[model samples]
Target: MSFTDELSTVADPLWDAIEGHPMVERLGAGTLSTDPFEYWVRQDYVYLVDYARVFAYGAGTAPDVARMGTFAELLDSTINTEMDLHRAYAAEFGISEAELEATEASPTTRAYTDFLVRTAATGSFGDLVAVLLPCMWGFNETAERLRERGKPDDERYAEWIDTYAGAEFTELTTWCKELMDDVARDASDAERERYRDLFYESGRYEYRFWDAAWRQEGWEL
Candidate 1:
């Protein structure tokens, strides 16, 4: 099996749990309340800022020119294109640009971004890819699955599913998986194990991110 395929096999249970998570299921059904989603949007805006940074780190840490270019393009797209779309979407829910900019990351959002950025900064390029795979792959899988159920009635929710399940996102996910496989191919067994651990940890964070949004989790003290 390809390295990414093997990783997916090991992470299947986490993927299943994420798919069954209440937030994901409700969002797919268009039955989710705006409050939690809005909370998600706010925190996610904050998350994306750091996510873009990880891509920047990826560009720097990339092993080859092609991979470096790809990471650079991703960084640009995330900061310029993706975030603008996010801002427009936030506007639909009465969230202003200032509000999105001012959003304080909840504990979960902070921790997730911190882990990602740290991995991108301190680990090997393969390590970065390992951690990064879950977010892109998981969302594409989730949205594709949701779309398979048919589009949600809520236009906003439907738009989200359409965005992630669209051809561009699918292509990007495929590229990342290919990159992961290439990286894993050259890795020592010990490094492969490290990558696997990071992958599993990131997958856990993916589930918690949705749960945090579902519960609108915030600092207790």
Candidate 2:
């Protein structure tokens, strides 16, 4: 098996938790509350801003121009494509783009984005594969299942599900998985193991991110 596949096998438990989380379950059944989803939108709007930066980091860290170009395209698509989706969703919520741009990251949002950027800053380019894979691939897989099972009578929520289940997103995940496999193939045994740990750690945060969105979790003031 390729390195990413191996990591996936080993990391099945954590990934499973994210896939089966209550928030995702609710969303799939059209039973999700608007308040929690709004909180998720606010937090995720900010989360994606930072998420785009990791792509920039990947570009700069790339060993070659082609790799850099891939990251650059991914970065642009993130800011332009994905964030546009957020803006559309925000409009439905009666939130302006300014408000989304101004959103303060809740504690969980901060923790998740911080963990991602820190990994990109301190680790090798290969490490980014582990850190970013769960996000790209996890969302695709989760939403794919949700779409297959379908819920959301609401267009707003249906739009959210359809976006992740769409062709563009599936392609994006495939690209990320390719990048991850390439990185893993070239890694030393020790480094591969370390990347596995990074996968687990980032994945743990992914699961918590859903729980946070479900509860709209915040620090007690």
Candidate 3:
């Protein structure tokens, strides 16, 4: 089966749980719309810098050595597609690169990015997929849904939603899921469970990050 099929089979329960959350409803309905979306985007760009470094570490440390070449390709592509794109987003929000680079990541952002780095550096390929797939898949799912729900019609919200719903982002998510499915075909039960857990954990973190951002002071800009 293809990665989308495998993801649907193995990841549905987790996605269902996230989809059922009240917060997801709030976000999807635009009830949670606020300036923090802009703030969070800026914060996210800060986090991506560290993410790029970690992926670079993976490129340097892969045991297969040839895996390093694959890792480098993935890292470069991700940096260009994801990180560089985020920089564009920052500019759109009137945020400067100097400000983004100098700002600190939230605790949640720090922990999430650190997990990716550690997993990439020390874990098996399956383990890295377990940590990374959820992020890609969840963001893609949420952004697409928000886009379809007319978020792009709202002047203040269009850019944020459009960025992740774009073709490149969706393709990135699909690529990651394909990688995960290839690994899953022969993975141990424990390995599969780890991926499931990561998927759910990352989803929960995603919800929390938005919730926190919405509720933070001065979120009404």
Evaluated with TM-score, which candidate comes out highest?
Answer: 1
Clash pairs, model 2 backbone: none
On lDDT, the candidate that comes out on top is 1
User: Residue-wise lDDT of candidate 2 within 98-206, one digit each (tens)?
Assistant: 9999998889899999999999999999888789998887788888888888657977778888999899999988988888888888879999888888888888888
Off by over 4 Å in 2: none
Of the candidates numbered 1 and 3, which has the greater TM-score value?
A: 1
Query: What local lDDT does model 3 show for residue 132?
Result: 69
Clashes of each: 0, 0, 0
Stretches off by above 4 angstroms in model 1 are none
lDDT of 1 by residue, 39-82 (tens): 88888889999999999999998878988999999999988877
lDDT of 3 by residue, 1-221 (tens): 55447556645665665555554555566664546666666667766676666657766655567657765876787667766666776787787878877766776676777767777778777777666677668777877777776764455356556767788778878777776777787888787777766655665666555555555423232
Give the Å shift of residue 155 in candidate 1.
Answer: 0.6
TM-score winner between candidates 1 and 2: 1
Q: lDDT score, residue 37, model 3?
A: 64
What lDDT does each candidate get? Answer: 0.91, 0.87, 0.66
Q: After superposition on all CA atoms, how large is the RMSD of candidate 2?
A: 1.2
- For all predicted structures, in order, the TM-scores are 0.97, 0.96, 0.75
If both were scored by lDDT, which would come out higher, candidate 1 or candidate 3?
1
